[model samples]
Every structure is written in C-alpha cells, then in structure tokens.
Target: MQTYPVDIDPEQLIRWLEAKHAASPSVFRITAVRATDERMVPPRGTHLDDLDREDLREIATIATLEIAPAHASEGWLLTVVVEDEVGPRLPDKGALIEDEQTIDLVTFDQEFIRTGRGNASVVAAVEGPEAEKRMARLLHSIEADRHNSGPAKSTD
Candidate 1:
C-alpha cells in the first residue's frame, strides 16, 4: 500500500490510480464531490467530465466512488451512495451501495465527503460489459465528479 499526503489534485489522484491500475487491476475508489443537479439527476449523460466550482455546491456529499477498470482505455465508475437517503435515488427506488471500501478522502478535499456531512451527487459509467451486473453486486453507484487539479471540488 502507498501513502499520500493530505490535499492533492483530483487528477493527480486519478493519475495515481491509473498508474496503480497499470501495475495491477484494482478498483479505484474516490471521494464524492459536491455537484449541481444538472448531471447528478437523470437522464445523466454518458462519460465523466470535470465539475465546476458553482456546480459542485448544489449536489450532495458523502458518497464514495468505486472505480473498477473494465477495459484498458475505459473503466466502470460507480458512485456508491450510502443507504442513507437525502439523495434523489436514480429510480427513486431499488438501488443503494454496500460494503465497498474507499480510500482516505482527505486528499480529495471535499469537506462534506471528508467530514461525512451531506448526501451525494453520483456519476457512474453505465457503459461496457458487466456494468449493470457489477453494479448489481454493489448498488447506488460509486463516484463523485470533482475532476481537474485544484482545491476540493466544492469548498466554501
């Protein structure tokens, strides 16, 4: 296991995970970031993108990201929303994440996630094989979209 200092760029974190993925296949779990309802609520677009500051504020917090590599160029992004509601469920039903371990969130810098405050804005990649099935094993998604290098996705 490797150790990272407190507060690092989200991209750097992802890059580090990518490197780790290169070394060996492991699910890259990340901290949830604040987000706007635009993307969090469906119909959600396919593919992950960077989140803006203002946008990050509107969304929920406290969600853990479970990124499992499905392909060399692509992977599965599951936003593991805890059973704790307060978040608008995808179907508003029948889905929630369980028993997935996420790394330390201090590095991500999202206060809500780091401190376990609010709900969460999820962004999971519903592409590739076994995507739905994998999510079936685990539920409610596993990622927050606080991309790019900087402070927490949403800090106020």
Candidate 2:
C-alpha cells in the first residue's frame, strides 16, 4: 500500500473516511490552527519563520475519527496529526473547525493516497458482530474511491 504524506488535506481525508463509514455511528473532528500563532508558539529559541511553509502548515492540523458500533459497549478511535496549507485561507481567526453529523461531500481527489493497512484496524477495534461487516464495507469503499475519477459524492 502507498503511504500518503502528512500534507494530505484534512477535509478530504475526513470526507473519504465519512463516505466509507457513514453507516456506523462515527464522529470525525478536524481542527486547524496556525503554527506560528502566539497561542501555538513556545517560549524557547524557535522562531515561527524558522520552519518551512510545508512544515508550518502541516504542524497546524489535528484530526480524530471515533467509531461507536451499534449495541456495542465500546468503540474505536483513530487520530491523525498532519500539516496542511489550507488553514491560512480560512476565516474565523486563522482556525477552521468542523463538526457535523454527515460527511460533507466536496472534491477530495488527489487529497489523500491509499496507505498502510487502510483503516481496517480502526474498524476491527470496534467490539461487536457488526464489526466485520463494517470493516468489509469500509475497505471496499476505500478501494473504490481510490480508483475513482472524482471525489466521492456528498450526501448533502
């Protein structure tokens, strides 16, 4: 499997994840902050300009995917920390936050690349008989999305 670099778009990743796993009761949270902002800076010798644009942007993103299986006592959590340059463009004090019930379908083609075991481990982490079905569906959806020409359709 290909390993996607940390520069992948957080929104796109979130969308792909949502597209494949929407049936399950899952929540995806994506937060982006400026790396050089006063709140994010350290008091040490490091200067904000010291870091390259890519690094600076990448250091700004915080993302988490949580899955709760139906009738299950416990759920699974998958978190990814990466960088992106898109945050600076967002309004609302250089931070963009998204919390929604359904995944917003926007074009995410080329935003993420297939990598690792995919999110199978995350699905497996859910404890219930439905885990296997969910896992299979997620895997298949991911594969289909990977080869598709455009972004996954938005359910909006």
Candidate 3:
C-alpha cells in the first residue's frame, strides 16, 4: 500500500483475517516491499534544503515480533512467518519485505497505524496470485515512468 492508513484497527484486521482463514486456507503474503520515507514524495517545489529531521527520519523495525501466533492476543503481537533468503533487516526494511512472509493481519495493521507516514511504501500481496500479478503490472508501469525511479503509491 501507499500512504499509511491512519484509522487502521487491529481488531478489525483480526476479524477480516479470521473470516479469510475461515473461508479458505489463504496465507497473507507480502511479495515485494521497498523501504522509503516521507521525503520520497515530498511536497512539490520542495528541495533537500526544505527538509527537516522528521522529513529525513526513517523507522526500521524495533522488533522482529512481539509474541508468537499461538500466544497472540489483542494485548500482544501475533506471528509473522518470514521466509529465508532476504538476509538481515535493513533500516529501509526493503530487505525484510523482499524476503517474503505470511504476516498476521493484526501485526501488519497495527504497524501501519503506529508508523503513520514514517515507513516507506510497501508492496503487500494479500490475495495471493492475483494480487501478485497486479503488483507486477503496477510496478512494471512504474518502471516505465520516465520521471520516477523509486517506489510509489496509488490511492485509487
């Protein structure tokens, strides 16, 4: 997704995930993620001199996880099944995201809320192959844009 969803609710995410899991054994896969910052989409006409500490400030994860899935509660963190090959987590978190994982909705939702507009844009594929294909198409389109070379978010 692009800009952080300010009204994200962990409980709502859990409900959706519970419903999704109930309907089918679908996993919440995050295929591609690019670590970025608010500066990535700075206000038009702005230059580096216009930036501030917060503008340049970026948040890498402070924790890999809070609690195990089996022990997860609204008061605690949930499980995220991260796969191998991405290497260590970077401040951008691009490496972490690219490694791929099936994340807990509660954890993922809470993160977007807590981070606000700090974390860079990430590519999450929640609906499996269709989502993946859509992301590929979208990124492909982004790659075609002559004015841009970094990640972008589309609100529509």
Candidate 4:
C-alpha cells in the first residue's frame, strides 16, 4: 500500500481516491466522517452532502476511514464515530453510526498536530469506488444548477 502525507487537504484527498478508482475497478470507498448530532440524525440516506454543518464539524475531528475489499460481496463502507458512547444501541436512534471500534485515539486527538498522519490516514481511507460515485453525484447536482442558471447580461 502506498503512503501519503497525513495532513491532507480534503479536495486532494478526493482526487487521490479518484485515482485509486481508476486503477482498481473493484475497490469501493467507504467514508466515515464525524457525526454532528450526538443524536445521529442525518437526512437518512447515502448522500454525504446532505450532512449538515454540525455533522461536518463532528466529522472534521474524527478521521473518516474507508475500506474496500477485493471481493464485492465482502465490501461495505462505514463511518466510524469516535466518542465515549459505547453500548448495544447507540445513545440516539438518529445517529446512523451504530457501531464502534477500539482505536488508539491518541493519534486523532493529541498526535495529529505533531505527526499529521492521523487525519491524512482518515482521508486516505475514503478513496474508493463508492466514495467516488457519491462525490460525482453531488458534483453533478451542483453542475446542473450552474448550467440551469440563465446567462448573465450587461446591467446597462
């Protein structure tokens, strides 16, 4: 696996994933951004852009990890939410991330500033096919809006 700088720009991260998709046809991207509402109340779908400002803030702190397995059946994307909430059912039903994993968060909290690798890893993880599709869809929507806008005319 190739290694990249940890402190990566979000846009750069997306481009990297796009490259990965081009190279590997089977690999899929899974994005795990932070959750804004402790309640986990998102619009209820795969649309990452639907994530609100609060959700983005929460995602900024935690690394959004994505993994794509070689086998299609085995491939599944998830958003890992790092917090104190641990139990059978999460604290809030609205929170979509219903699972948790034990990771050395020292890197996410204390060491990212010094090493910069923690956040970069998070961005790297999301570079997969699924992620590319979602990103493309969102971009298409934005482009459609711009195209639909009427041409500008002189005020004079």
Q: Per-residue error at 9 for model 1, in Å?
A: 24
The residue-level lDDT of candidate 2 at 110 comes to: 28
- Return the top candidate by lDDT: 1
Residue-level lDDT of model 4, residues 109-143, one tens digit each, is 33333344333432222345664454344334333
Predicted structure 3, TM vs. truth: 0.24
lDDT (Cα, tens digit) per residue for candidate 3, span 1-156: 121122223333334444544444322222222232221333445454544423443323322222212211211122222212222222353433233234444455455434442322222222344434444444344344322323222222
Each candidate's lDDT (Cα)? 0.38, 0.35, 0.32, 0.37
Off by over 4 Å in 1: 1-25, 29-66, 70-75, 80-104, 140-156
The predicted structure with the larger TM-score, 1 or 3, is: 1
Q: Which TM-score value belongs to model 4?
A: 0.25
Task: Please give me the total number of clashing residue pairs in predicted model 3.
Answer: 0
lDDT computed for candidate 1 = 0.38
Alpha-carbon TM-score of each model against the true structure: 0.28, 0.28, 0.24, 0.25
Going through the candidates in the order shown, the clash numbers are: 14, 1, 0, 7
Worst 10 residues of 2 by lDDT: 115-124
lDDT pick, better of 1 and 3: 1
Q: Tell me model 4's lDDT, rounded to 2 decimals.
A: 0.37
